[model samples]
Target chain A: MELTLHVWRQKNGQDSGKMVTYKARDVAPESSFLEMLDQVNEDLIKQNDEPIAFDHDCREGICGSCSMMINGKAHGGRKGTTTCQLHMRSFKDGEQIYIEPWRAKAFPVVKDLVVDRGAFDRIISSGGFVSVNTGGVPDANAILISKQSADTAMDAAECIGCGACVAACKNASSMLFVAAKVSQFANLPQGQPERMQRVSNMVEQMDKEGFGNCTNYFECEAACPKQISVGFIANMNRDYLKASLLHQEPVGKA
Target chain B: MSWIVRLQKSSLGSKYIMAITGAGLFVFLIGHIAGNLLLYFGQEAMNAYALSLHHLPYGLLWVARGGLLVFALAHVFIAYRLSFHNRAARPQRYQYEATLQASFASRTMPYTGTLVLLFILFHLAQFTFHLVAYNGPYTDSLGRDDVYTMVVNAFQNPVYSVLYIISMLVIGFHLSHGLSSMWQSLGLNHQKYNLLFRKLSPLAGWVLCLAAASIPLAVLVGVIK
Candidate 1:
């Protein structure tokens, strides 16, 4: 199948980007979306032109590295599927595909189809962890956890930090991402010690990062490649409220 | 920064304000609708209810009104602030954005909320302040402010009835998203009950809208005369 692509191109973060058109000729229908882009890049290299730059690692979809707005949708409009997993057959012959980087103030364009998602890492660094000291590994069964709680925690833990939630949200909110991190810990027994502090610090970091607030639009759930639920956000909100109301110590101080 | 300042400055904190204030207002709406439904019980019953409210001890009526005013102001103020934050968060928008999960009510929250606010002001002016004249006399047999007569006379006018019904519908739309979203914002959500809230939120909105609209329609059609 042949396809016309309008891909956003930029020299660097400082460069003003614009949509540059390219044609993917004689592409196989079975080729993944990233593979199709690779084919296009190979052709560009032969002609001595700069290839389109995009982020992709572990094309199997777990890394959450491949981020792009294909046809104005995060991850090519496929629910629970990343760009690297999207196949060319999703489009028809001669179809025009518009590709752009994630359009959030937090995620700036790095180059063609690539945006710097370092903000996500910074948000995570703020408090997305358990501060438990490294001692002898405790018996897994020593701290008995209910199956339901464990499953809920695992569900929140599935978030890949892709920033697609921010890309898809009208407000560019990272509430879902932060919520997932907060919920993963909040739901577990081991995560209880600093639960309040964790929520407050992470939320403060998310705010400082210039992400928008969640208005319960549920777009993040729809656009999430990992199919993360917005319920985690509610959990995060609950934790933050408790922490804000009851805990007097500043986030980092505690 | 102080916690209060952080709460005020953070986007999520403002949403918490909206949720809390919206919940307070929701409670007021239920009470208001119940009182208005007294119109179905005839003029004496409605007037007695109004008199009872006015006669509450310790200046309770003023206190309740004052509380509602604060809730209204907080809800609207936080919402306005969040909207500005939302716009600034996304300076560049998608060329062809498509929504997959957000409802029509969810997308048009600001417009519906503003409409509801205007409707509330108009309602208060017409009924509470008597700034707008009713088509007929408002006095009851006991020389009290005949709440039922005022409502019936106002609805008897085609223009007022239609406007009332339309405004109620807009309020319904606002409540459809607002009620359940308040739950999520306040972290009252649970996996077991989240679906229930989502389904019931809109149902509650429809119930309020229809119940409120029914009074005007009934009055307009001479069912309550």
Candidate 2:
């Protein structure tokens, strides 16, 4: 199959970028979207031109390293599929695809089809961890977790920290991402020691990162590769409000 | 920072304000529509009801008015503030933008909300302040302010009725997103009622606006006479 690609090209973080069109000749239907881009890059390299740059790791889709907006939909608009999991056969013969990096002030473009997602790391660092030492790994039943809670926690844990939620949100809000991280810990017994602090700190960091607020549009859920539910956002909001109102902590120097 | 200030500065805090104030204003609209529905019962019922309100013993009406004004101002204030912040979050927009699930009403909320606020001001000017179009120190035989006649006079003009209908549609559009989003913002989510919560917005929006708009259409058609 052959395809027409309109790919955003930027030399570096400081360089302004534009969509540069290219032709993909003799492409295989089974090739993943990233593999197809690799072919395009190879052709560019053979011609002594700078190849279109994009991020990818573990083409298996778990690392959350691959990020791009294909035709303006995160991860190529396929449900529960990452860009690396997207196949060329999903497109019609000679189809034109527009690819661009995630658009968010927090996730600025670093190069063609690559935006820095370090803000996500900062948000997680703020309070996404269980600081208390639970001492050695215990017996499976020692924690006394309900099946329902375990499932809920696992569901929230599926979030890959890809900024698709921010990319797809009209406000560029990272609420879904932060909510998932918070929910994953909040639903677990181990996360109880600092539940209020975790939500409060993570949310504060998220807002400080310049992400917008969720208006309950739920576009982020639809664009999510892991199909992470927006219900986690509701949980996070509930927890955050409770923390702001009821959680008492001593005023101390930083 | 103070916890109150922390809450105010947070993104979720602004949403909470929008949701709470929006819910308050929505309830007020329901009462407004229910009261106006008395128009179908003839001038006596409407005038009597209006007169009873005018004679409230301890300025309770002023309190309610004050509360509504505060709700409205905060609602509009947070909406624009969030809108500006939201716009700045994305300095560049996608060239081939396509929304997977955001409804048309949800996308145009700020615009529709602004239009509805303007409509509310115009409506208050005509009906509450008696400052536009109608000439009357109108009173019924019982010597009460003739609110029924004032409302009928205002709606009798085709242009006025048309403007009113259009404004109601815009209000309905705003409510289509706001009403249901209120629950979501308040973190009132459960799997059992999620579908109901989602459906609440459009269903209530259509029903409430249709009922409100019906009064003007009825007046214009002389049905109230």
Candidate 3:
């Protein structure tokens, strides 16, 4: 099958980018979207040109490494699937696919179809982890979490740090992503020590990052491979509001 | 700290402001429509309505009007800034087509707002200030050329009534997303309120739309004349 690709190409973080059209031939209908890109890269190598760069690893989609904006969607037109999981069968023969990187002011383009998602990392570092000592594993029953709490925690923990939520949001807001990280710990007893601090600091960090605000589009949920609910966003909001209200800065108003 | 500065400068801040201002606007629209509803009774009744408002003690009227002005300015400023920022971030329309898959009102706020802004200006000129040179006769709250009666006489013109009705339809379009967006901005995240606001916003929007649109339709059709 033949495919017309409108692939974004950027030299580096400093340079502006443009969409370059490439005619890819002999694509296999059974091949995944990454496989089709591999074919195109091979052709580029034969022509002694720099292959279009993109991000993918563990092609199985669990690592949250495979990222691309196929057409207008975050991980292509398919729902609940990553780019590497999307197969050519989803596209018609002779189809034109628009591919680009995860876009947000925080996630600057590091290279073609690759963005610096370090903002998300900073958000996590601010408070995405439990304060349990890492010297040795604690007893399994040290904290007897209710079945419901454990289940809800697991649901929030399913987030893979992909920037799809930010990409899908009209404002490029990462509320869903930040909310998931906050909810995972805040829901469990192990995370109680830093619960208030975690929500406050992480939300502050998220704001420091260039991500936009959530506008209730629900596009983030629709685009998210894990389908993290917007409920967590509400939880984060409640916690943050409480924290800010209680811990007023000594100086000027927040 | 600079971190706080950076946070507020981000796109998220604009959306927050949008949601907050939108909520205030939604509340204001309801009151405005309710006030307009008096036109249904008769000229004397509507004029008394305006007179009642003017009779408020202290600086209350000035405060309300001042607050409204601030809200309108901030809302329009924030919306324009956000839209421009969104455009700059994209720099180009999507190569592939995408649909909103939402209500018609949800889809056209940006465009409808532009029209509504013009309509608002015309509205202020025609009725608020009596500066539009409209030949229609209007009786005031104290039985003078009050703006409320101008509202009635203007609606008597089918053309004016249709314009008002169409503009209200646009307002409905604006409200649909505006209300939800505001709830989100206020950070009202409890699932109970989330469901409550979702149900409440659309109903409120529809009520305002119906009430506002009904006035002109009634007068134009001679139901209220």
Candidate 4:
């Protein structure tokens, strides 16, 4: 199949980017979206032209590294499918595909179809962890967590940190991402000790990173590749409210 | 740090402020609509309801009005703050923007809210302050303030009724998103109640706005003279 591609091109972060058109000829329908791009790049290299640059570590989609807005949609608007997993057959013959990077102040464009998502890492480092002694591995059954709670935790843990939620949100709010990170622990026994502090610290970091607030539109859930639920956001909101208001620990301890 | 200061600084805190104030305003809307429905019961009943509100002791009516003003101001103020913050978050927009899930009402909250606020100001001028051309220090047969006649005279004008009906539609549009948003912002979501909670916004929005609009429609049709 032949396809026309409008890809974003940028020299560096300092250089303002623009869309550049390219042609993908002799592309196989069975080939993945990334493979089609690779073929296009190979042709560009043979012609002594700059190739489009994007991020993709694991083509399997678990690494959440392959981030791009295809046709103005995160991960090509496929249900639970990443760009690397999307096939060329998803489009018709001779279709024009518009590919761009995620748009967010927190996620700046690094190059063609690549945006920096280091803000997510900062949010995680702030509180997205459980403090535990490294003396020994505890028995999994020792905690005696309910099956329902375990299921909730596991569901929330499916988040891949792809920043699609940020990209799709009109406000560019990372609430859904932060909510997933917060809820994965909030639903478990081991997450009990630092529940209050975790939400407070992580939320503070998220605010400092200049992400917008969630207005309950649920756009993040729709864009999420892992199909993360907005219920986590409500859990985070509940926990944050309690943490900030009712559970204020003493000055030095907190 | 004080929780008050903390609430002022955080994003979730901002949502809480909006939810709490929005919930208050929503309750006031319910009461306002309920009171206005008295117009359907004839002029005497409507005038009596107005008189009862005026007869409250210790200037309680004034206190209620003041509280509503505070809620409206806070709701609008935080809305602006959040809008600016949201706009700044996406300094550069997508060239080919597409919305997959957000409703028309959810996306247009600020515009609808601004329209509602303007309507409220105009409504106050026309009715509450009696500053419009139909100003009435009117007295009924019982020597009471004839609020019923004032309302009837106002809605009888085709221009006034049309403006009122349009304003009601806008208010309904605003509440369709806002009522549901309040529950989520307050951390009140559950799987069992989620469906009901989601339906509550649009259902309540239409019901309340239509109920309020009914009075003007009835007056225009000469049913409440």
Ranking by DockQ: 2, 4, 1, 3
Compose the digit string of candidate 1's lDDT tens values, residues A56-133: 999999999999998878998798899999999899999999998898888888787788888888877888888877
Residues B49-135, candidate 3: write the lDDT tens digits.
787788788978898899888888878877776666554443334455343233455545567777878888988887777677476
For model 1, how does the per-residue alpha-carbon lDDT over B1-225 read when each residue is reduced to its tens digit?
A: 588888777777788889889989988999999998999999899999999999999999999999999899989888888888888888888766777689999988989999998998899888878888545457876899888878888888889999999999999989999988988888877768867678887798789889999998998888999
Candidate lDDT (C-alpha), each? 0.88, 0.91, 0.78, 0.91
TM-score for model 3?
0.87
Error of 3 at A41 (Å): 1.7
Clashes of each: 0, 0, 5, 0
lDDT of 4 by residue, B161-207 (tens): 98999999999999999889888998889989987679966798789
Give the number of the best model, judged by DockQ: 2
- Which stretches of model 4 miss by more than 4 angstroms? A250-254, B133-135
Question: What's model 1's TM-score?
Answer: 0.93
Q: Calculate DockQ per candidate and list them.
A: 0.68, 0.86, 0.36, 0.80
The best-first sequence of candidates by TM-score reads 2, 4, 1, 3
Model 3 regions more than 4 Å off: A134-137, A248-254, B1-20, B57-59, B77-94, B97-118, B140-148, B157-159, B189-195
